[model samples]
Target chain A: MSKGKIYLIPTTLGDSPINDVLPPKTIDILSQLQHFAVENIRTTRRYIKKVIPEKDINQITFHLLNKHTSISEIRHILQSVEQGIDLGIISEAGNPCIADPGSLLTREAHRNNLQIIPLTGPSSILLALISSGMNGQNFAFNGYLPISPQERIKKLRQLEKKSQSEQQPQIFMETPYRNKQMIESIIKTCHPETLLCIATNLTLSNEFIKTAPISYWKKHIPEIHKQPCIFIIGA
Target chain B: MSKGKIYLIPTTLGDSPINDVLPPKTIDILSQLQHFAVENIRTTRRYIKKVIPEKDINQITFHLLNKHTSISEIRHILQSVEQGIDLGIISEAGNPCIADPGSLLTREAHRNNLQIIPLTGPSSILLALISSGMNGQNFAFNGYLPISPQERIKKLRQLEKKSQSEQQPQIFMETPYRNKQMIESIIKTCHPETLLCIATNLTLSNEFIKTAPISYWKKHIPEIHKQPCIFIIGA
Candidate 1:
């Protein structure tokens, strides 16, 4: 009989200083894992070195598990847990099974009856939602807008209509460089009265969560074209 | 001018045992607050003493604050901050401002331009949503449904229809003791094929996050009528 084992630890939001705020017990658990499933092996190695500097952490090899990984790799992850090996899964930042990369693995872990453990840490989505003061009762997170301007506008329009009719909040993110275009699309396509929330640099020294009507945004965010940001519209 | 003062600091769920899981810096911040505004000052004081035994937290008084407190009392809180006093806001458990008691104070703090610090902690709603594998992209937290079954059902039906039509996720909670009827109501009113998630004992030893179609839940959930659960229906 194998020991029950599964760990889903939260990493920090990649570019924030608060990104380094993992609990001590989580670090202790990381050191105990027989194999660490990391989104980026190089970055994971550096993070571990910072905490456990004197140890040979490289002995515990990392299995890169990103979106491109084959389904076979998921099976190996399940197999390792079945053998009683504690497996630590982490995204580049924030909670793993969230809007981040580890949901597929988490779904499989659930099916296999593995003991899933969720550790505490920074979560950009929750922070944005709570502070947005929009509707917290009913909200949806649309991961990323289409990069093409036309497609992005089309999706934004659909989201806006759905959000308004249902009185539910709609949230989405954009690449650092494409932020301006996304904001512009929101201004052009969304109702001027629509409530828009921009949460940028969350949990960092410069964390900001701003909520304003769409018309007000056009006047202020003239040059915010390219920055990694989470945009929210409350119906 | 007096130094900028501390504001509310909501922590993770469960007993203070979970507090041990927070980052070290968070603990340091909690310690520095000269005053803690909590639902139960005694409980908060006891929790602080248990977690950080060496620190004499007696000098840091706790001002009991709850939903019953008046607007003038809220002003008094701000006045203390103006006098260079620090404040820590804690709920019975979990993060504040999520249908919790400290929201008024939080708003007041924001209006006053006081530096509001939100610590990364557990939120039952987020825990339930992420683990349930429901629609995470957009969610609306309705807080708690009406106590009367008829009103509750009406709200549930409205939410169900809206969710289905808009593809939005609706979230709500019930007191721990009222968990059973909430589940039954959903099983009877929501469509048989509708997806429902029941998250209970979040961040606690007995925590469980369960999901199933309403029809399946109707037949399987004999012990889950009123048990302090958060229900999620994903359209």
Candidate 2:
């Protein structure tokens, strides 16, 4: 029997409309699958219901695969795929296996020689980069910076230097609650003339994306408290 | 008057169904726009027609923004947006302003203080990484590799070393016709234990994606001549 495929499904970024970010084909696949390995079972259930209202939330099987999931447990999750049962992996938001715990399952799926398919969907990082007007041809996504204030400042300086010398934009994000502090740290650490782009609430009706010099942002800082944002710095 | 927004549109990867990669909202936005700055006028027109067949193609205005477009011409393209006319930027395939010529227009739009909006759509690089089972939290997209054989080999070795030391995957692509040669160079240059993932014809029915060590690839090489492929090297 052919091994079942592992599909990397993408969810909406925030409160964006379901049809705005996901294609009909993705929804079709979600409706057909009965098994899912997700970062958060609650959010996965809510998202599935949003996309497929007819789907029985109670009938679907959900396996936890967050940061707390053990490596051994990931192997057990792939057992279903090996047994000819197709499985889907969904993150809390955005595309799975990207800045999310879904990669653990996909990594294990490869070790088991299972076919992996990634369905099309929204990705905040790509949306931020393409709209930043910075160097998209060459860029590094460092995920998140050091949480400590002092260490974060040091890292910010390093990123600025790298961006100027390499002519490559540096992309990173911070926890939503710390979004304002992250922006403040960027303003306080980088040179006044450096270009910084902040994209918040992407794909939503209240989406805001702008890129300007640090000096310009210092005079008119936007409120991004407790909101998801992707920051990019370049010369 | 409020400045017109610049929408960074996404085109299909290949000959995939229109509804498979793009959302209905994107099509709605595409149908409403009358002007577009595109990498290739022919492909952009074909894509627009596929998505919005009822629209009159002759009524739309297409401005070429490929490698040959000059800085002065880009400034002229933004003039329409400044006049309160929204414009869309489309690449030959995939998302605009990403390893494509659309960035020039976006950068200029930012300099003019225009609102830049990136609609949700398919991105091949992100799809490849998400499916590669590689590091997605911290990764770098190096776009295309050097063309010279010696330079390409040196770059491949550098990428392999970076992947091992940084624990970050390095992604790069090659021209479709040079797909096989690129794979040969990678296998010949990287260490046997280094993991390499090759994803080709992504989002299409005949799509093929695989991840394995360099040694495994050397023994069972796949034919991918004249195919769009993304390669990732990781430990």
Candidate 3:
């Protein structure tokens, strides 16, 4: 049997309609796939149902992968693909492998020489980036900061210095609930003249993207507690 | 009059069908816009025609923005938006403000406090990253390399060191025509153990993506001459 290809599918950022962020081809491909490796089975099922409602959800098989997933299990998941069963890796939010655990499976796919196809969709990182009006020509996405206050602040200083020397925007994110604390750290640790961009609730109705210096952000910080946000530190 | 939004629209990476990469909202927004800021007028006009065949192309007003465009010109283009005229920034290929000159307009819009809504679409950089099976959690896109071979090799060394130090992938690209030169430089300079990913003709019918060590690549280098490509150096 011919080896099945692995489709790297993307899910919506939030409650926004799928049509607003995804192409028609994504749904067309999802309808034919019966095996999937997903970050969250429930969310992936819901996303698939939103576009391909006719499918019998019970007929499909799901493999759950997270930070706890092991390499042996990842290889086990690909056994189906080895036998000509196609698999799709769907993330809870955004593109698989981007700020998510999808890359683990993708890496294994490369090892096995399986065809991996990545579909285009709503990526908060890319969306926040294009809207920030920062330096998009050259930028980096440093997924998340350290949880420790001191370590996080030190990392911020390092990113800020790199952004200045390279004249590039340094992009990063934080856990939703800790948005305020992240804001405070940036405001306090970075230079006053350093430009910062805070992009929150992207693709949703209440989307907000603003770029300003640390001094301006000190007095007008928004209520982004528990909101998904992307932060960029640049010139 | 209420202010109009600056729609950061995206074009296809190559000749892939519009519906294959862009969402329905993109064509909807493009149909209604009478003003556009584009990298190249001819390509943008052709793109609009492909999606909105019935619309008369002549009625739309386009402001060309490129490497040579001045900040004053970008501000002048926004005069209509200030008067509630919706404007879309279209690039020759892929998303605007990403490895394109569209950010000048986006930056000016931010300066004026205009609403900048970035629509989702194909981004070669993001697509390549997700497909690479590399560390997408932490990565950087250094848009291009120095034309001079020596400087280009030096920059490659810097990126490779940074990649090894951070355990992050350093993504970069080169002008299509000089792709072979780039591949040669990587084979000759980068460490044998270093991993490299070369994604070519992304989103097109003939897409190619592969990640392997420099030693493995030395024995088998694919023909990527004069083809749009993205390269990544990682651990």
Candidate 4:
């Protein structure tokens, strides 16, 4: 049999179905596929449940395809594709491949000359930038801040300077646990009047978008620590 | 009356609804607003008609708010918001405020402490970037290249050097008519080995994504200039 196509599906980050609007039809398309390679089987099961609330989870076959999975598993996924088995790849949130492990699969697929179809969906980074009134004409998305506090601050400083020089915006994010420290670093290191945007709980009821100079944030010291957030510093 | 919220709704670039996937709920929200500010009132009205097929065009007001519009008009838009009248703003296509006239209004809203809600929807830049299989981690979407051919080539050269030195992707596009010329310049100026991605008709049926070194584009000159495209140069 001839090889089948690859579909990169987008998943929601948290409770907001607002971003998952296309998942129902997406799942319908995946149902006809031969394999559904998901970031996490259990998580994908939960998402599939939420997307098609009336369906039974027991009917779906989800294969785990995250970082922990070995190389052999990936080869098996490729082999399935080679056998004309349609494959559906999904992330835990947003579109797959960007700052996600699924990129490796996408790269491999391209190398093998497989047909890859990317479905349209919500992206937290773009949503944050579009909503935050920053230099949208030119902006950079640096997936996540460095883990080390010192390195992260250095990166933020670089981001701020780049934005200023190019009159472009720099975008980055931090894990929930490290968000507060990231904010503190921005407050201490960035210039007083430097523009900064913090987008949190995007697409959810608790969503908040704060855009102001670094000085403004210093005054309030927002409680940003345990939230999934995106940071943008403008030049 | 309490001041109403201002929303930056994203529409598509052309006359078709295929590129537009904004939910019906967003259209309903847009229809109820007293002031609807758009990049081109005529074009926006045509797109809005596609989304809300049954709405009476006479019932809704569309304010032309392109760069040519005066500050008084913008002030009036703000005044409407201040007076508790909700307003809707849209660009010709994709999300407003990003490389669109809505940015100025958004900045003004930020300064005035008015609520600005960004609904999740189509984004031409992100759609193009993600589909290109280019470096999405570190990317800069420079709005448009210089109109003059000499300046455009110079800017491309500068962006090429910056992209190489900094290990970041640089994205820029030309107006529809000049796309062919830009492609020719990119082929001539950029090194043969440098990767170039042309994402055209994004999110539509005839959508095309071509990622190749300048060498490959030089070979396929005929097909490259066929559509409205976004040119991405990846390091």
**Each model's number of backbone clashes?**
27, 0, 0, 7
Model 4, residue B202: distance off in Å is 1.3
Better of 3 and 4 by DockQ: 3
| Candidate achieving higher DockQ, 1 or 2 | 2
**Ten residues in a row with the worst lDDT in model 3 chain A?**
A106-115
Candidate 4 RMSD to the correct structure: 2.6
Q: How close is candidate 2 to the true structure, as a TM-score?
A: 0.99
Fraction of native contacts under 8 Å reproduced by each candidate:
0.28, 0.81, 0.74, 0.34
What lDDT does the true structure give each of the candidates? 0.72, 0.91, 0.90, 0.75
List pairs with backbone clashes in candidate 4. Answer: A163-A235, A164-A235, B2-B84, B3-B84, B4-B84, B11-B94, B12-B93
Q: Which segments of candidate 2 are over 4 A away from where they belong?
A: none
Best by lDDT: 2
Q: What DockQ results do all the predictions give, each relative to the true complex?
A: 0.36, 0.85, 0.82, 0.46
Q: Which digits, one per residue and each the tens of the lDDT, describe model 2 over residues A100-212?
A: 88888888788778999999899999999999999888999998899999999999999999899989899999999998899899999999999999999999888999899
Which run of 10 residues does model 1 chain B get worst, by summed lDDT? Answer: B3-12
Evaluation by TM-score, superior candidate among 1 and 4: 4
Query: Which regions of candidate 3 deviate over 4 angstroms?
Result: none
TM-score-best of 3 and 4: 3
